[model samples]
Every structure is written in C-alpha cells, then in structure tokens.
Target: MMIALTILALCLCTCTLAGELFEPQANAQNTKASGATIKADPFQQRGLCRRWAHQSTVKNGTLYMFGGSMLLKQNNTVQEVPNTEFLQLDLAQSFQLSENTVPWQKPKINGDTIPPAFSAGAMYSGKGDFVFLYEGQTPKNLPEQPSSMWGYSLINRTWQMTDRWNHADENFPNRQSRGASVMTSDGNTGFYIGGLRAYENDTFKGWYYGPEEQFTVIDLAAGKKSKMERLPLGQKRIGPNVVYLPIGKKGSLVLVGGTGEYKVRLSAPVQNATKMDGINPDDVRLNPMSQMDTIWIYDIDAGRWFYQTAVGDKPWERKNFCMVAATSDPDSSGNKTHHIFIYGGGTDYMTPMFGMNDKPFDDMYILSLPAFRYYQVKLGDVKPDARQRMTCHVVNNKQMLVLGGHRVNSSETLKDCRWDELNLFDMNTLKWQTEYNPSDPGDSKFIPNPDVIAALGAKTQEPALGWEDEDVKCLFTGICPGEQGIEAQKKRSNARWRKWYIAVGGAGGALIMALIITMLFLRRRRKENKALRYELEQLQLYFQYQTTGEIYSSTGVNNLISDGDAFVSEKVRPMTFGERVKFVFGKKGSNNQEIPTIFDLPSEKRRETEVEKIP
Candidate 1:
C-alpha cells in the first residue's frame, strides 16, 4: 500500500514538472487569432545553383553579391563555374516580375570582377565597402596551391592588388579546406581560423599543422602582410565555427565546436601510401576525431581565452553548420548582445567523407552571450534531410536567410538542392513564416530569400538585449534542479495519505477500548449476583426456624425441610444486592398487618357478613 502511494505521488509530480517546462502560453491563442501574413518571393522555384556569398556592401539602397560557384554540367560530368561579375540588386525594386510589368532587374557589371571561384573563405568589410575573397580551389587537373587573396571595393568600383599579400612567407600556413575567414569592423583586418591542410609527405613524422595553430590575423590595410602570433602549440583541432562576440566597450571572439587531433596507428596497406609513409606507423598523427560542443571565448583586449558554459541540450555534434552574427542595430549604440545562430550541420564525422546516407537536421538554436542562454527556437514541424555546407545570413535582428545545400535521396545520389524560399522567424514571436515564388510551376524548394540578403545590410530597428549580471542567477533559478520542486510536491501529496492513516488508526483504537470495558463490566455484575444468592439462602433458613418455633427431629423430615429451604432460597434469590433487603422487609410487613393469605381470617369475615344479612 505504501509503495503504491509513493508511485502515485511520483507520477503526479512528473506531470506537474513537464507542464512547467513545455506548457503553452495563454497568449499563444491570442497571437494565433491575430493571423500574421507573410509575402512570398517570386523567385522560389528557379533551378539555379548559386554559391553562398556575403553581401558585399549596401550603396544607394542597392545590395551587391559577388563571385560564387555555379553548377555547370555537361556529358554526365558536373563542374562548378566561378562567377567574377558583380550583380547589383536594388532593394526598392523588389517586386514580382511579370510579363506585362518590368521589375527591378539585377544587372551584372562586366568590368567589376572578383578573383576566381572559391567556396568557403569569403567575407565582407561593411565599413570599407570592400569584399575580401581568399583561399578557394582553382579548377586544375591536379591539386594546386591556393595562393591568391583578392579585394574588390564597391565604392571605388575597382579591384586592387596588394604587394605584401602576394609575397608568401614560411610562417604563413598554406590555404585550408572548409576554413573560415571573417572581416573585423575596422574593415582593414581579417581573422582566419581552422580547416584541413595538405599533407606534405607519406610519413606522419612531418610537423602536424592546420588545427591548433591555424589562426592568423590578416592586416589588409598593411597590404595583407601580417606576422603570425607565436603561441605554444596546442592540440590540433578543425571544423571550428568562429564568431565575433561584441563585449561591452570591448570585443571578444568566440569559437564553438570543432574536432581535435590525436594519434592513430596505420595499417601497412594505408601506411604504404605516399603521405602515410612519411609518418611513423606507431605514431601517425591524425586530426582528432572528437566532436566538440564546447565554446571558447577569446578576449581581444586581454589576449586570453575564457571558456563559457555549454549551451543547449546535447546538440548534434557535427561540422559545417551555418552560423551568422548580428551586423547592424538601429536601436541603442549598437547590437548590445552578440547573438550567434547555429543550424543544420552533419552529425557523423565518417558520414561527410564516406557519404553516410542520412538525413540532416532542420532545428535552429541561438546562443546569447554574456547571459550565455541557449534558446532552442521552435521551427515548427520541419522534416530533416542533408543540408551540409548551407549558408546563413542575418536579415536584421529577427530573421535569418538560409541558402543552397546538398540533399541526398534514398538512391544515394547527391542532388544540388536550392532552398529558393526564405524562412522568416520573428525573434519576438518565435514562429516561422516562409516567403517563396507562388507563380513558379516547380515545387517550391526552401531557400533563404535574397531580400533577406538585402535586409542583412540594413540597420536593425533595435539593439538586442544583452545578458545582464543578474541573468546568471535567473538562468540557474529557471533550471529544474534535480527535480526538487517535483519531489516537494510529491511529499505534499503523500502527506494526505499520512493524515488519513492517522485518522483511521485513532478511530479503530477507540472502538477496541470501548468493547473491552463493556465486557469487564458484564463479568463483574455476574459475580455480584452469585454472592447475593448465597446471602438469600441463609436468610431463608433463618425465616423457616422463626415461623415453625419447635421442629420435629426426624431424619426424613429434617432432610425434607433442608431441601425445601434450599429451594425457597434459590427461587427467591435477589436479582441485585439491593433487592435482597427489600424482599426480607416485604415478608415482615405482611405478617404484621395480618395479611389475607391466611384462610381462617377470610372464613370468619364471611360468617359474620351472612348473619348480619339474615337479620
């Protein structure tokens, strides 16, 4: 019984806890009733493969997108064509292009060309109005060195070459694959972080590079030639997502989730390879295979690393996820809180390389710094598929625009899928609204809208709220610590059962005491009756002697007399002790008053009455 009550308490407690965590707000019904409408873009279903690139700069309300690789295939062979031309898209000209009406057309500039095709390392300097393009593979028959860094100025409408950057130094590491390079606000500096580096020889004995020491600060104002910061060699790590966190009156850089380096033994067949043979078989240095969800913060002012708390429930540990930071804020001094949005990355390490046929995630997560609150923004019901290497850009403070990524189908074929549609989520509402081309005949593919691209460069309406000092306490308090509240509620429920048991036990004890007392009283009364009977017998014997005066002394007669006295005592025995004295007094009263029990007294009265009637 006790165990059942405990289980019941636990179940109720769990229900209450769950309700607290995921209960829908009462205002949610009101918001739904209001019914928000989102306009869809006309360019959602176009079968175009556009490489993800940053918005170069906003000039005269026109947003410019530069060089990106486009899919150009022929004869069953697919090749990526790098675009050098600048496409100018007017923000005011945004409208549905119809046959009768002319919409704002994106005009391509012939003279303004960017350095050839690149996939990953592209960043824009908003203040300088220059786009920095660096370190992407050139179309070559064999593996070639990536040696060029190009800059295109939108304001001057010209491309300039830097002599210092052209000169290669021994300290400067080689270009890496899937590496990230971002421009600082000063517009003259670019920070480069981790990716994969080329293996020089077959032996693993060669110096391990491309992981820990792969960070360099490029001074574009100094003609791109900058000295590397010499620091102690840490563990080799890669695939790190880096973002600049704006500190109060200062700035800090934060890096989240990357793989590290470790030693692995190579088989003889693998060891015989050119690059593998260079390394000792016993100590083959390889990129560390650990997936990191850890966030490391680097203070720009202090030149030190400070670790922050991990955000979110165990996130899907993967690489190449899309991340973007807030660029502009119309409210307050600037974007108060440096928010980083992360979405859609691969979970399997071997999957990206070996092509594990699995679906990608569609979940969106936000990391708000200083407060370090990780909010899992509800994206509603979105089916997951492969979306590795997709691009994300912040369109104002509320919405993010996501672009093209690879989708793998059941046949194990990789198809270049463009989410030609833009998904808009209001930060305040946390509800998703999609915009796409409604007129398009093809099925609408989800893509980040280009209008969002325009919005990214626009100033935000308000600066985001940063984490205050009190947020730390608030965060800890909000967390359900070991289900303490649940346990307390369980105890409260159990208290009811405890009260019931005490009541029942008290009633049962009273009843048992009453029954025992009644039985004892009845037993004592029976003993008293027996004692009164003995006293009555003795009185009867005394009465017989007084009534007779002289007695015949014969054996038979004495026996008879004794028996008769015993019978009279038994018959006339008092019902209670008090009754014995009353019986004795009543017999004496009848004798004194000459009671009518005597037959001679009645006959004498009858004879006297008859003589009086005859006269």
Candidate 2:
C-alpha cells in the first residue's frame, strides 16, 4: 500500500495539468464506486427488459421502482418472467438532460425479507425513511396474507416484514386492495376502503366476499390500526387507483375507476385477445357497477362514503392505469379547481403478442374538481404508446413523470415505454410534452373543455358533484378551509343579513315613535289656542260695560244702593293667561306682593340654600 501511494504521489508531481486530472476523477467517483455493488453509466441494472405491474414512488427527488414481471421470447413461445429487482432513478438529474426516456438506477439490496410484491401498494413513512408495501400477490400469483406488512428502509437498504395489527417498534396496518391505496400528504396516515380480500384472513376459503364492510386507517404517526365508521356497500374491484387529498384534518380518499372484477375467468373471447404473461387479463368476473364507471369517495372526517357519476365521455371502465393530482395555481395558469389526470391503460391486454398493435382505450381524461366533470384531454401530436400498469409521479407541482410500463403482447420491440424517454404531462395546459423544463410555463391559462361543458349543461348554482355532501365538496374547493366553502360562505351570508335586519328594524321603529310624538304636540297646541280665543272675547265685552256705567259709593249704605247693584251684576275678567305665565316665571312674582320664586322652596331649604332666580 505504501509503495502504490508513493508511485501515485510521484506521478501527480510529474503531471503538468492537475486541474484536468481531478475533473474526470470526480466524475468517475460517482459512476464507479468503491466495489462491485454499483453499476456504471445508466446506473440501472435490473428492469431493463419489457415489463409491467411494477410499483413506484418518489421521495426526496428520487424515484424508487420495483416488483413487476418481465416478458421474454423463447423460440416459438412467449415466456413470463417474474422480477424482484428494486431500482431507483435520480429525477432531478435525469430530467435535466432528458432524452427519449428517464434514467433508472439499481440499488443491490441484500435480503430475503419480503415475498413477491407486484400488485401491492407502496407508501413512504416516517418522513421518507421507509417505503411500506401493502398486501399483494405471492410468487405463485396467489393473494398474500392480509396480516403481513412488508417494509423496505431506504437508509439501510434492507427489507423486513411485520404482523399486520401487531406493532412493537414500528407501525403498519391499513391494508389496501389489489387495486391501489393512497397515503396522506404529510406521510403519517393511509386511507383505503372496500378491500377485495380480507385484511385479517383466518383462512383462504373465499376469493371474494360481499362488498367490503370495513374502512381502515393505518396511522403510522399515531402508531395504531383502526377502522372508520363508514361501510359503503359497492362493487368489489381489482387494480383501482386511489388518491388522498388533504381536505380536512383526516383528509379524504378518492376511489377512481378500476378493474371492476373480483376474479378474472379466462373465456374464449379473452383467450384470443393475447398469448400473454403473468396476471395478463385474468378471466376476471367483473361486478355490474364496474362497467357503469363509478367514483366512490370516503370522507375521513365525516366517516361516510359518497357515490357520484361523471358526464363526459369517460374512458371505458378499465384498470392498471396511472392517476395523479395537483392543486391549481390560478395566479399563474389554470382554473382554481384541483385536477386529477388519467392516462394510458386498456380495458384488457389487447397488444399483439408479436408486434406493435395499438390497443383500445388508449386515451387520457381529466377529472377537474368543484365541477366533477370528465373532459377527454386533447393529446398533442406526440403521444405515449398504449400501455397498462405504469406508475405516474407528480413533480414540482406542475408535471407528472410517467415511468416503467410494458406491453405484455410485444416480445421483441418496446412499445409502451421507451427505456430512454421521459414521459411528461403539463397540468396547466393539459398537454403532453417529451421534455421537462421548469422555465417553460406550459400554458398561460386553462380553458374548460367544450365537450365536457356541454354535457355538464347549466348547473343550478349548486356544486355539480359535492351537492349531496358538504365535507366532500370542501375537499375539492374552498368550501371547508379558510372560509372558502359553502358552509363558511353560508355563515358569512347569514351574518351579513342579520346585520341589515337589525339596522333596518331599529331605524324604522324610531321613525314611527317620532311621528306619534309630533302629532300629539300639534294637537295639544290647537286645544290651548282655542280656549285662549274665547277668554279674550269675554274680556273685551266686560271692559266695554264698565266704561259705559259708573258706581258712586259715599258709605256702605250708598255702596249697597244706586248703580252698585248694576255694577255687581256685571261679570269681571281676571288677568290674561299670558300675564299669569309671566308672573309665575321671569321673577315677576317677586315684585307683585308674592314671595320670591327661589325663597318659596320648602321651609328648610329656603334659608340654607340660595337658589338662583329663573331666567
């Protein structure tokens, strides 16, 4: 070791350009590492061949893909090869250079901790340290036990299985159907409803039961396994995709279209479809409602299930497609409604076993919120080939990166996914793009699809979808949070009306009282004036009689006799009412032989208090 170090030191001293030598060394350090554990260049060692049904998820900007089947051609017959190679891709680095396909990396993990997990659900927990796999098919293509929860730790690169309901050091429960399951945005909880199989299976006696009667919650953050109060009776499904939107504290799960069959039975029509591989178009017996294109929603906070139907030309009832959601940013582009994108799946495996045969149902649809209408997205000139069982991961809140799917029918050529391509969809414009660029604003504004609008017709001012359930409506629009929902809006409306009612009622009552008081004032003034006019006429007549006749009185005898009798018979008038009012007020009573108005107070107060005279 010392001799090798001395020679390397001597070579470094002899080199002319040290900076150039170090540059390639830095690149080599990333591509080729310490041992045989890592791969060179593309970084992906497994899952390079044609495959499908693999599960994928993104955590901390890295895409982890694993567990699917590979299709191989041997002489005259098609072969189905089951794969268990866990791989990853650096999305931040891959999309920046981004050619025909996104790049993938293989992390050689050493363990036999988990069984075959192709049709299982994948979720990240504890802030992205571990990715948990829900129940799926075994290597023999049989259903895995519902009680067993398998998890892979990214930090340790090891897999370990635990009891479903039992938790000692870690948390797991929340079984998902063969369809699909979704976790909360914070990575703490999982929400799923209507399992095709039982989570606590004591015996594998039945393949399907009467529609699921349990709504389960696998709360990793709280470290408990429990069931919700909602038990909706609906058709059982396989390969359905679920989405968890954070509407309230518990959030809600949207159960979109899935394969409506519980068990696929191979018949003559399906037999001629394709000579395919593992779980390829199973002779599954579909439920009635599956063909009806139903959407089931479970509101976690309300603990209830709601049923809805879409009006647009919804893609024929199919499964094994990718569905992803992103909130809208009206300030830049798109409407204020949230959007869920559905793309690239088939009703059955219709790809020709030998060549590129375009399958039916090879289209995309958009489920825009608040209006819950389906719009067939107009695919641009460049579109992805028809495929099934692919995983779509949303990136940077603007685009969805579709990765890793295969046509089971194709043996020699790759039709569904190109191993060197990046499949991207711009959410704002609802357009498909081969390259991903952050600076590119996909669309300045999103206009509604005319076909869907025509089908939606004129709505009756109520929410088209969430009209039945307020909480479910809140999940989609500004209905529940930030005073943006109907309940919040109604509360505000009632408050405003209440204020107006109080103000108008109070003002009207006061005006009515003022009118009554004014009428009484005028009536009292008229009555007093009438009496004053009569008294003034009598005084004028009495004064005239006294001027015409005279009274002479020498003593009491003469006062009683002569014109005194006539003068006595005449009526005399007292002082006018106006003069009496003046005498009582304005200090006139003090000058007239009457006690001063201020001194006329009750005896005790007259001497002690010097009251001021009236003005």
Candidate 3:
C-alpha cells in the first residue's frame, strides 16, 4: 500500500512539471473574442512602420523583428534611414485588453553585439533558439565590412557575429537580397533561391537567371567556414518564397510563384527591349515575365525537381507574397499534406534600366497540397491593402497575423510609399480584421463584427482523399534525430520497454527486501524488550521480598509488565512506507553506513527548562 502511495505521488509531480511547459487552450477562445491586437493603458510607442527588407519570426510567444532600412520623410523628401534598434512584441502582455495601450520592448544591446543596420533575410532556428540574419544590402555611409552571417540568441538575449560568406566572392553564387530561403527540418541545410544582383551604375552584373538559374546551399551548422555550393535550378526565381514540406521519407521543398528570369548581354544590341532607344549599341536587355503561374517542387531525398499541374482555380503569378502552411492532415496510410495560404504581393517589377514598377495584389488563396489544388478565399466586404515584402504569421492555425510592408499610397509613387497597417485574417471566417494601427495612430482594439461571427458559425472542414503509399527513400533519415523507419522505430521502442521493465523490477525487488528486513528488525526489538521486561520484573520481585519479606501482589506485577511493554512500543514505533522507500533509494550516510532503524533512535528523555515548566 505504501508503494502504491509513493508511485501516485511521483506521478503527480511528473504531471505538474509537464503541465508547466504548455499553456492551456483557454487562451485560444479568448483570442478569438479579443482579436489579435493587444491594448493597454501604459504602452511603449514603437514605430515598426516604413521599414523595408525586415524579417519577422515568432519565438516563445513573442514576435521578433530584425534588420531593415527605414524610410523616413525628411525635408519634404523620402530618405533611406538606418538605425540600431531591434523590436520584440510580447503576445501575453499584448493580450491583456484591460490595459489601454500595448508596448513592445527593445532589448538592450551592449557594444557591437548587433550591427546598427543591414537589410537581409532572417530565419528562426526553433531548435537552437537562435535567429540567423543572412547577408543583405547595407547603406553606403556605414563602414564597409566583409559579407558575413550573424546570429541572435533569444534565450541569451545576445547577438554574436558569425562566419562571413561573401556573395561577391567567386566561391559563392550571385548576391541575393529579395531571394527565397528555407531551412530544412533539421535546421542544418539552408537553400537560397534566385535573387537579382546589385545594380551598378549602368548595368546589372550578375542576374541570378541570366541563362543559368542557380541557387546557393549553406551548411548553417558549420557557420562561416561552411561549404557554399552553387547548383543549377530549373529556372530563375526573383522574390519567391520557399516552403519546407516534411512529409515523405525525405520531405520536399516547394517554390511558389515569382518573377521569372530575364537575361541581359553587353555583347550585342537588343531590339524590342524597353528603354533601349538611346542605350549603347552593344548592350542588350531581356524583359522578364511579370509574374509566373508555375509552381516548382524539389525532392530533397531524390535530388530531383518536378512540377505538378494544379487542377482547380489558381492564383495569379506574384512575388514577395506571404505564403505559409497553416495546417496539415494525414491520410489513412500515414501520408500527410499541408494546406498553404498565400496572401498579398506584387506582380510586376522590372530591372532598373527599364524603370521599376510593381502591381500589388490584395487577394488570398489556399493551395491544398499532395493534390496540388487551389481554392480562392473571397473577402466579401473587407480586404487588406495591396502590399508586397510583408510578413504573415499563423496564429494557432486559426488566423494569420499580417505585419509591416510598404506600398504606394494614393498621392505617392513606388519610391515614396507608406507602411501598411497590421491586419489579421480569420482562417475560419474568411474575414479581415485590423489588428494594430501603426498610424495610431495608436494601438486600438478591434471589436468583432456580428455579421462575420454569424457567417463563421459553421466550421470549415477539409475534404478527404484516398492516396496510394509508395516506397520512397528516407531523405530526412538523419535530419531529425531518432526519427527512422517503422521497423527501426519499433525495435528501439521495444528495447526501451525492456530496459524500463528491468529497472522497475530491480527497484521493486529492493523495496520488498527492505520491507522484510524492517519487519524482522521490529520483531527482534520486541523480543529484546520482552526479555528486558522479564529481567526487570524478577529484580523488582527480589527487591520487594528483601524489603518486606512478603510477595508482591500478582495484579501489581501484571501492571508493571504492561507498563514496560507500552513504553518500549512508544519509543520504537514501526517505520512508515515513505521512510522505508527513502531508506532504500536515498543516499547513504557518511562511510556508506546502513540506514538506522527505529531502535537506533536516541533514547534520552528531554529535561524541561524552568520557563517551559512554568508555561
């Protein structure tokens, strides 16, 4: 019975520890009612708007934004602004609607831990609690530094400079800024897709898609000295997004729509090219397709690339769109596919020579995978402004949080644009809700619309499909540690069970032995007490006979023996189960001495002090 109680107590402790790791689902319901914006009275006013090339990622229930060029209006002209500030938004604090305002905290940076300003793509390593900032364009005024990769640890709240991999170096591929990058499930391999080269005074030197579509692969674990390999791709991609699909033996990488390749050569004159009227006779410019409707898939395990023809209604070709896998479902055969949601982006952007322009989009589309199908979500009354280079994050698989991106306002051109407002799209309701008003221009709470809530009363469900399971080589074999084939996993599981059984059996045997030993000791102590009592009784009878030459009453002798037995039992009580278990499992005394039994306890009677006796 004591063993059962001990096991119950241990189980309770284990469950309590596990509960602290994950929060309860009650917050999900509260979030739905409160929307996404956090409003408090005392809030920090942080300007997250008008920043370009910045990246955002969610960690520890907080949103972290890093590295971007700020566009500030100075002296009636837009100027490229650089700063040494990093931003983090605490979701828990923001959700407290009781406060009138919500504030985002900027962590303190000591010395040169984080560079003042750089424009680049950043990725969050959830496994390591680190955020990697890739090399990107920097302002001209800043000191020229070697191209390098950097890391910021969320756990340590510190930034450290990592190894340098120069894009201009012959060893590396073309320089990338608006390119697509995605880390493998293991967070070791990073695949960088196509990006345009830096525009020189008169020409673009290394266009990623100039006859040769190439991508660079980096081993993130190796840091700066990591092997940089440039490999050929199917076609050139500019401003595309890559999604890692972790399903099959080796998961696949999918590249969504982007501006396809355009080639330029200085060797020959080009005809029918835009803005070639007064250009040099030797220069030729190729006009790239504004947008691509094609979707590219790369099989990581097989080192192969394939395209699937999506049958349903499809979205337009776009670039810099926010695309994320909101959720996934598995079939009866254990084959899983994800549901991807693509949001607003631009359609057309030309090279500097031809004059740059972008046609933004505000539509949303859902691409169901493995089946390669598309479903357009119609926004009835509300729609987000058309913007590109913006970031969208999924919130609990129910809503998408849209953050900062620049767009041409009614009175402004592309060069002079304003930041878009924070928007939230409900996946279930198919409605758009304003989250934070960067304009303020203050943090404001959004009340839910009654009509939209009524419309979303019925929950949406995904259609089921039957699929055939094919034998595929495991691409993620070592990527995810300990994840293996069914047979191997089963064998390992069986071994674990065997070891656990052995340990439990050994502990149980020890506990039983401890119980038996305790019982024997108690019995021996009782016998010794009885013998001592008998000896004392004999001595007491001798004393009585010597004093009065008369035998003591039989009743008096019985009472004396009874009193002795009670005293010994009170002094040496039996041990509780908890005490026995501790004796068996707890560390031994000095010199590895055996645990003391109840009989070994001090037998001294306490002497009352004067104050205690009076009290």
**Higher-scoring candidate on TM-score, 1 or 3:** 3
lDDT of each: 0.41, 0.49, 0.49
- C-alpha TM-scores of all predictions: 0.50, 0.56, 0.55
> What lDDT is reached at residue 585 by model 1?
11
Model number with the top TM-score: 2
Q: Which parts of model 1 are misplaced by more than 4 Å?
A: 1-64, 72-88, 91-114, 140-146, 163-173, 186-188, 198-208, 211-213, 220-225, 230-235, 262-292, 326-338, 351-359, 382-386, 409-425, 436-615
TM-score, structure 1 vs. true: 0.50
| Model 3 C-alpha lDDT per residue in residues 191-269, reported as the tens digit of each score | 7676654422222233333233246566666544244333323356567787887754467787777655434312111
> 611 in model 2: Cα distance from truth in Å?
96
Q: How many residue pairs clash in each candidate?
A: 19, 18, 8
Error of 1 at 172 (Å): 12
Question: What lDDT is reached at residue 520 by model 2?
Answer: 43
Sorted on TM-score, best first, the list reads 2, 3, 1
> What C-alpha lDDT, on a 0 to 100 scale, does residue 399 get in candidate 2?
75
Stretches > 4 Å off in candidate 3: 1-49, 74-77, 95-102, 140-145, 167-175, 186-188, 199-213, 220-234, 262-287, 290-293, 331-337, 349-356, 409-421, 435-615
Q: What is the per-residue lDDT of model 1 for residues 108-215, given as tens digits with 9 covering 90 to 100?
A: 222423344344454444344555555543322223344556666666655554422332444433444455555555565666666554323223212225433366
